[model samples]
Target chain A: MSQIDEQLRTELQRQGVWVTSMQDLYNWGRKNSIWPLQFGLACCAIEMIATAASRYDIARFGGEVFRPSPRQADLMIVAGTVTKKMAPQIVRLFNQMADPKYVIAMGACAISGGPFKQGYNVLKGIDRYIPVDVYIPGCPPRPEALLHAFMELQRKIDEQKLTGADKAEFLKPDQPSEFPVPRFGRHDLEPRANPNVFQPPVLER
Target chain B: MSATIETLEAMERPPVSMASRLQGELLEVSMGPQHPSTHGVFRMNVALEGEIVRKLKPVFGYLHRNHEKIGENTSYLGSMPYTDRLDYFCSMTNNWAYALSVEKLAGIEVPERAEYLRVILAELTRLQNHASLLGFLLSDMGAWGTPLMYAFREREKILDLFESLAGSRMMCDYMRFGGCRVDPSDEWLAQAKQIAERFPKFLDEFEDLILGNEIVIGRTQNVGKLSAELAVNAGITGPMLRACGVNYDIRKVDGYGFYPRFKFRIPLGEHGDTYDRLMMRALEMRESVQILKQAFAQVQPGPVMNPKAKIRAFRPPVGEAYGHIEAPKGELGFYLISDGSPNPYRYRVRPPSFINLTILEDMCLGHTVADVMVILGSVDIVMGEVDR
Candidate 1:
């Protein structure tokens, strides 16, 4: 019965009626092995560290392999307030990361500039510049909340459609040519390439 | 015999030209606005001549959240949580400092019991901050996370107590303008006392593990010297200054809260090198334990906040006040100007790390590149505090 079951399964795979498509396998592999970059910008970074520590143990979700280098990481957990000064570097790091990469903006600051929203220096939201896959909200969200975000990212990956070559722009096999890196001006990051989009309204008398 | 000894010293050192003596070109190295060892986005631009560092410059503002500016924008009560992000490690002390200034400005009085509670929580914050400082110091020393994890283990217990009382772990935001947000039960205080009693034992074990080790000794001793005179002139306060044998703790001088009654020694270091800074933190934790024990005993049953003061709607007269405390890092001060308004006329944080970081180049010169990490770790500048 064991041998027959094995042969039947193999034959089923050989025919059109199989376990799953190569796309599903690829998605599954990418989803489970989501390696995050070791990046922290502020108070939330402490919570991130606690999550990685013994008690919370992010290793359970396969995110324990925190790559210090962006080149090796498949995910970026922007763990704190991304300020105007730090925004360019954050975008640069995102640009450096390889394909099939995902970005999870993980805190109030990352989500919508947080308690420091009134502050001029803090960026309004990370998603305003780079594309954000998921956003976790809290004034430095608890580690469990971040873990939940990771789970949501996993679900998002599981739900992706990848077949017939009509792929999502983000799902394209080729690495993005370049993320428009912002340059520092007098007060803020000027995405000069996309001028009109980010320009503030001119005050009228 | 003196002439012969002088002749021998001169023979040992060949008289070389000053140009030849300083021959090698210096190499520039940027440690971080983002790197593992700089301890949260602090940048140290260094000039290295061969292995030895010729100059160092600390560049901050990467993690600046515009804390002072935001403080001015928000109401006095709204600024409490922002203080938590100041040092990020010593949230309790930061909250207390901010609250103390607001209380002074508004002429609001905190109840007697609230002062004891503040002392109790402040000591606990010191314990945890110093514990994690040890962890980070050892991590910077390249022991990876062995001692670091042990320190975190001890810190986790203190954080658990905080989480139960304050709702958040790192950013407690529990302090109010009049008093505090929550008062722990008898059971909670008893448990906190238990943890405080157990801290000294953990400190002892921690010291036995890494304090006297040869590698720690070699890397730390007689390295990154900041003389007591220079420390005073540079406005360096807290453990870094105290580590230089200057017993200038604000708790003792200003005698804030119940610090006057408590019995604790101001631990000082002879050399003020990296080793002394590490040892000073270890010693300070013991002092905090003693203070916590006293607070646990003396914390009497009374009202937590003054009945006269309305917390939600507080408006102060036209005046300015500066409230300061011996934060675990250094002297954290909050200067507030009130023009009889709910919002402060101007809000300023005299951040310890930001001021303390001015001496980085002074400390790092004449040491090797590796010692740069040692010195920076010794300084213990949280990028949040420095840039804020």
Candidate 2:
């Protein structure tokens, strides 16, 4: 089959005739209806509520159905500080989520532990355990910032290939859906960071 | 219900060989750590016989980031922003409580204009907190997001005021030791006054929607009853204590800040049940509006910060001081002991949510598992403060 010219494609679209690949249709449906898990951890969770609420209505982007169960949710917004004690439970929740799930580390705390990084109980970052798709940075990022990150996630989803070596990770059967849940050791969480998920660059002074 | 209570009591204090007379096995259920309605990361270990909750134990420290430990490690000025994360809802009040403690320790005097500004901000914080609490309580009762959306619609206006003046919507670290960080413009004050003027209408609209609803009344009226004696004995404060018909608001008792200058009545409730607790917040929001009106009227042009008070390298005297304020939730107090150093020798927060949760089991006894959610919502335990 010959590739359709841009002018011809435009003419077809104007006439209500649409041309789209299966990958485009799949990504379009997935991106538009990204249902977030109804979970809140700390201060940033309040801002997350604000984003979901009336004024910042996350429903505008079709990402408003905040499912209470991980099985029904497509997005896991780790929306606040992840403490050492709660890290295992968070990881467990993530593992319970179905394939084609994405994680949004929704605050500085979720991204790099924020200001509470110095605290003994605070996990340095949630990315230490599970793979995070989007990282929004702020003490507690405003609702507007959260929406921006959501759009960024959508854009990333839009670019995913259907059939190729670099196809979406969720499409790969060998890709692990679950990560290791850390345990509470004497001083810190056992296996401080997941070797597979986290790779911090070496710093030389 | 009386028979159920009797059976619950009998189960609590089993008589000799009563185990043989007792019915089926009690099922132990842990309700949280990731529940939709536990508020935030709070866990309740509940033992149930059918639908009624027989035994309840609240598990804590899930969201704990060692707040006090962090406060102790950081400098006096450095800990201010962290206070915003404590209650999360009433950051202004948390900042005031901590600042009040540090000022008491250092013996710094807050200016008149600054005091007025603090009053205005605190009352605004109160209004938003109560509105959202009611919304959350209703949502837990299965009203879901309609009421919460209504609450947030009003909350966004107040947050706009905060974002304009204090620089952040939720995390407003605007209070310094002796005064506020920035002075609000006359335009800001006018906008706040307009919001205050319009708040009662929202309350009226909210009441029309929820107050007389059969479902709300049925679910909340007799559920989670707390006796006046138990409330006082368990060290309950804020709206929870007032819900028990106690007239012990710290704003009136301690006369901290400009509260004594303003004329506002403390709303009291009878029956001390979930409905009373819910109504207490509604009534208190009305009182807070009155306070805001007065503070806005009396506020004059002057320095927002006290010139004598130091921000960086702030070291209070070598003595301990405990200062408390009537935060939206309850009596939020901060205790600090300075060692003539930048960081305090000891820093402790007497979080209202944590202390208020002490009587969780007592209130939850004999109630249904669903009622437990409503009761916990009435308690309003923000996990950041509860676990911190």
Best by lDDT: 2
Candidate 2: Cα lDDT at B272: 94
The 10 consecutive residues of candidate 1 chain B with the worst lDDT sum are B10-19
Which candidate tops DockQ? 2
Query: Per candidate, chain B TM-score?
Result: 0.93, 0.95
- Candidate 1, B1-388: lDDT as tens digits: 3543553343334324322445756566677766777788777766667899865666678888898888887788888888998888889999999999888887788888889999999999999888888888888898886777787788889999999999988889888877888788999999999999998888889889899999999999999999999999889999999989998999999998789999999999988899999999999998999999988998888888777777677777899999999999899999999987888999999999888888887788788999889888888878888888
TM-score of each: 0.89, 0.96
Model 1 misplaced regions, further than 4 Å: A1-29, A158-162, A166-177, A192-205, B1-23
Candidate 1 backbone collisions, by pair:
none
Candidate 1: tens digits of C-alpha lDDT, residues A1-205: 1124767778997887766556667778877888998888988888888787767778888888888788999899998888888888888888898777888999999977898887888888887767788888887788899899998998888777675466655767574534788898876778633342234458999
Candidate 1's displacement at residue B289, Å, is 0.8
